[model samples]
Target: MLFNSYTFLVLFLPLTLVVFQLLRRGNQRMAMGWLVAMSLLYYGWWNPDPSKPWTPFYLILICTSCMINFWIGRFLAAHTFTPKGRLILGLGLTANLGVLFYYKYIGLFERTMEALTLGKFSIPDVVLPLGLSFFTFQKIAFLVDAYRGKTSKYNFLDFLLFVTFFPQLIAGPIVHHNEIMPQIQRTVSPSRRSVDLSVGISLFAMGLFKKVVIADNLAMVANPLFGAVAAAGGRDLTMLEAWAAAISYSLQLYFDFSGYSDMAIGAARMFGIKLPVNFHSPYKATSIVDFWRRWHITLSRFLRDYVYFSLGGNRKGPILRYSNLLITMLLGGLWHGAGWTYILWGGMHGLFLCVNHAWFALRKKLSIPALPKPLAIFLTFVVVVAAWVPFRAGAFELAANGSAQEALRATKSILASMFGLNGFEGWPNAAASEVKFSWAMRAMSCVLIVWLMPNSQQVMRRYFPSIGLRGLLAKTSMPGPRRFWQWRPTWQWTVFTVILVMGSIYEFDKVSEFIYFQF
Candidate 1:
């Protein structure tokens, strides 16, 4: 169920909270078990139909996956990583990845091989299970940590709750076992439930406003422009249209995802659990490296620790490190979808990161002065928005059934217009004055918000136990007294939050799924 939906807001959330609060007073295990059942129900709540037959298997698949991985983690923890342990770890990795491959990549693999060999085999498109990418990574992290003997004393129930915790389960901040398990163990105490509730409500209200009011509205501007370009052949979009479309989608994605992160964190907070900060005003980042650091913070952590570090990380020299960076990003891109456009997106970022690192290396040697922070932030945002063309194209292709060539062509067309390679003579290109005014205002408004605003984490920064990656503690919260706008248990803030919720509710009839759900 979408966190934005009325059913979730009106029914599911309050009911769960009430039950959890009541059960917390009694047995803690029952409270945890209740959540597990509800989360499973939440995942299975999306109805299976003739079109997507695989939807029915989502529940069974997740449970089986949890069962298998939980035991493997236990096995890895109980043994040493010598002869048999290494072998089991390998098999464990293979088993998890194999299921991922079968559902997420097999169709793309088949189609690619068929095209290469001039074969005519028809490949059915695979609708990957919801939360598969996220939970798989979390599970893999668990297994690897277990192998290193970092994880211990985890029972199946605690492990299961960690994996299927509904708020972050579908599209995640990708919670780690270490980050969330202790919180699960302590849910029985309602000691801070009131504080958590207010914080949760504030976060949810702001996020809901972001998703329904901002992101969905921006999608109206973006979707049509991209759709026109992705038609059976393509359309010639003017420079104004192209850049506006790209930036609109980028902003849409930002609010859609970060908004989701805020709501997820908020909902979890209602249960007195603090999820790690995932999106912390990433567009505010001044470099590609910084962008990754802020955007999808957990996924970056996963790739860095598991993928890059495993490949020898920066412990290696420059050449191998750069190559490893590219490889990791390519894999990261592919993890988003089984599409060449996604791969291209990854390749572009990989190249960007390599260049970014190379520039840092040169600066260190030559003692070059850094660009002013504002300029760096602007340039970084431009590059990031340019990269989003391919990502937006690939996301559209998931529904368009468009070929890789078409996706590439569409991406190139947009990028060309964005860069002034395409014609700009007929700017706004016959759009009505009001239509143009509305569109420009909406897109530019989002741009200003991205550049100027404090994020959800910052607004709620007064709260403790909030997790931020290294160097981001200050970013997550200011050092001094609570800012006037910072969230607190106050009457004024309650009214402000109500206004935000009201604005969100006005758009409730137009509820839409979040953009990241496709991942």
Candidate 2:
């Protein structure tokens, strides 16, 4: 269920929180069991739907995958560092990836065959389980860590809770066993409860406002334009239309995914568990490499530690380093979806990183000065924005026929329009008026906020969920020169929160799934 949905916000969350807190007073294990049961219910809520009978199959699939990985992790932990252990780890990895590839890539493979043979074959419809990509990666990481003796022995219950904790289960900051299990074991206290509730609600409200008020609204502006371009087979787009569509989507995805991350982190915080920070004002990054460090911070860590390092990383010299980067990103893109557009998107980023590294080396050789911060940020933003065309276009294609060539055509068309290779015949005046100027203004406002505003972490720097506030005023005060925004329990903050809540509530009738939900 969506965190923004009425049933979840009003019923599921409140009821679960109250019961969990009450249960914790007497039996911690019971409280933990309550959470596990609630999480499973949350994950399986959509099952048994009339329209999608196959939905329930996902529950079975996820449970089976979890059980398999749990045993694999235990086995690795037992045998640690032995040749036999390495073989077992390799087999476990293969098993996990084999499941992923069959479900995720089978459709893509079928489509490729059809394209090659001129419709001589038909592709079967494959319904990918929600969050399969995310949870699978988390388990793979666990197995690897167990093999390297990086993870301690964990009980099945703890492992289940770690993987199925509702907040980060579907989409994740990709929690590590070491990072989360200790927090799960901590005893709940009144002070801790109060602090978690306060901080969690604050972060959730901010994220809710971003998703409902900003991102969903921007989707109206973006979806149609991109859909039209794709429908026309990437034929025509005016300069204004192309820029508007691209920029709108760039901001739309940022707020959508970032909002989801905040909600996930906030939800975990409410239970006195802290998920890793996934986004860190990535638009402010000065380079592609820097952008990756900030955006999807956890995924970057996963790719670097597991994929890049395993492939020799930079240890083998610049040539191998660049090759590893390309390989990692190519896989990373495919992990996002089963399309060539994603592959290209990944390849582009890999190319950018390689060039970035090469430039850094050259700068050191000739003692060249760094670009001004503002200029660097602007250039990086532009490059990132351009790269998003393929990502967004790929989504459109994947939703339709899962054809790689179709995705490439859409990407090319959008890029052509974006670069003004298409003629300057702007959107018809009526079509332009239909969208109205307010959307452009909203998009600009979002850009301004990302560029200038302090993030949630900055606003609540001194208010970790476990630690009680230092002092109301002191904790709410600006912590740094760059942090102009702060959160206080003052009248202004109250009104602000209320307005955001009400605005979000007012739009409940049109509740939309988050963009990342498909992945």
**Residue pairs in steric clash, candidate 2?**
none
TM-score of 2: 0.93
Q: What is the TM-score of each candidate against the true structure?
A: 0.96, 0.93
Which window of ten consecutive residues has the lowest lDDT sum in model 1? 426-435
- Report the C-alpha lDDT of model 2 over 1-519, residue by residue, as the tens digit: 898899899999989888988898898878888998898889888653457554567777888888999998888988999999999999999999998888888877877777788776555666777788888899999999998888876777788889899999888878888888887777867887887877788888888988998899889888877777777443456777777778889999999888898888888888878888787788999999899987888888899999999999999999999999999999998888888888889999999999999999999999999999999999999899899999998886687554566667777877888787886665657654436556655664678888998676667665643221232225344344434366755678677778878989987777998888877
Model 1, 1-519: lDDT tens digits are 899988899999999989988887888899899999898888988764547554557798899999999998999898857677788999999999999999988877876988799887776766688888999999999999998899968889999999999999999989899989988886533547888888888888888999999999898888888877888756767777787888898999999998898899888888888899888788999999999989999999999999999999988799999999999999999998889999999999999999999999999999999999999999999999999999988965555466787788899999998888887634454542213646855685789888887777777776752566335865443555768877788889889999999999998878998877877
The parts of candidate 2 lying over 4 Å away from their true place are 52-55, 117-123, 233-235, 424-428, 431-434, 465-484, 489-492
Best by TM-score: 1
